[model samples]
Target: MQTISAPRADARTPVETPAPLLHSIVLDWYRENARDLPWRTPEASPWAVMVSEFMLQQTPVKRVLPAYAAWLERWPTPARLAADAPGEAVRMWGRLGYPRRALRLHAAATAIVERHGGRVPDDHAELLALPGVGEYTAAAVASFAFKQRHAVLDTNVRRVFARAVTGVEYPANATTAAERRVATGLLPAADEVAAEWAVAVMELGALVCTARSPECGGCPLRAQCAWQRAGCPPHQGPARRGQSYEGTDRQVRGKLLAVLRAQHGPVPRGQLDVVWPDDIQRDRALDGLVADGLVEPLADGYFQLPQ
Candidate 1:
């Protein structure tokens, strides 16, 4: 147990988080209310967990469900995915929104096969070293898949903490060192407990303490929530912008990639032209895609997934 101290201004002292109340109430509520997500089950392999992490990024659970199953079915192992072309990975990605994640997951699988014998690394640092894996993803895979004790601060978890503990409507647009430090302090001392708490907090945020229209009356933490006690003030922080897809370069790229994903081999440039009408924007999107390594341009001007 940590020695409780009054608030300090020093960097060494982490800001106090609601420790026992957070740990117990959240865990118990999670056991009763948590959705039976497949990836969290005992049968899911570490690779399955890793793949789920990759597919879940910015994409909704409903959208990712079928893609995750099909992706794993085709390339069950990291080596299998690594052996295939990037185009195949992108193609398998379907309409997952961010096709780049598929490409990065492929790259990560390649790295895993090459460096770690196809096993998703259990160590946080090693996981972070893998392509497409960031601090949150690394910690998530390690703690959730490997049962390591780590603070998994995803968007949902951050929102939960912001409301329940920090008395804020939302966390900063970006994560901060202070936020991480507080998360670390909030972790249960027991490894297994800490691991469970990580997912529990995340599930609470996802299902209950959502970004908008939180079901506070139904929430177990409602009585203890600081934001509620503080009269639920509106967010005074910078505007969190929503992404737009219509007529943007991203939409053009998606259209272009759709043409290629439908084909097993290289497609002629003319096929891509019909996806988008404006020649200048379409060309820019294609050029950006090729430059980003998501699409490959052959000597004959045909396009395909990277070999």
Candidate 2:
């Protein structure tokens, strides 16, 4: 995949404030049509919101729903998760893929327990300092969970901004410094309003301004959308690369983890060897898992999830 060359921050054009009607329209649509996701519920805890953000990274919402519920039901708070063995987190993660996220969540839970008194912090910097919480996750938890005024720029929100504000079919392949300025400029002045605006824009993109086939007719911003006004041009930049699963190390890792997860304790090295035929790839996958802290080896020829 070609790297997208975004203009330097100084050279980028300023983003105009979206019309007030734009907010009302999108917000109203969100209020009515937004998916009844558990994370968005009034009763959802800050921890729940943060967990959802972690699970939703590259995974879809549908796959996340059951896992998210089971996770919280088992470990209702950061303290609970922190107290449990890390292997349990991995087991409960259950085919979510990128099982390392489960490990990171466990680490983050431990950090929250030690640093924040088991509370998911509202402060962006504190959230960022937690394991696996990056700029987007921190902003998401701060904005969606705590209702703080931060620019929450995920893939969905970026798509919304690209089409509605920038008249582009897609955002730059990478989140550039200039994109940060665009999000900042368009943020509402009032903190509460800005928070609502953030999620509203994200919801719009998820439901309406979708990546491959946007349902433009149902979009609240269709009438005023820049992309619509300009006749919705196709993406002209570098070709987007599709993630291939076949014959990949990721697939091998998942197969290895599945074997581990099916058992209650350590498995013999020979047991793991039978999952994949390629000796080198299988060995590389096992080594990668051990390096990632997802697997631990005993003095004997037995492998287990981290204790």
- Would you list the C-alpha lDDT of every candidate in the order shown? 0.88, 0.88
Model 2, span 134-181: residue lDDT tens: 999999999988888998999998998788777889998889887787
Clashing pairs in 1: none
Whole-model lDDT, model 2: 0.88
Runs in model 2 lying further than 4 Å from the true structure:
1-18
Q: What are the runs in model 1 whose C-alpha is more than 4 Å off?
A: 1-18
Model 2 lDDT at residue 184: 83
Q: Report the poorest 10 consecutive residues by lDDT, candidate 1.
A: 1-10
Tens-digit lDDT track of model 1 for 48-80: 999999999998899889998999899999999
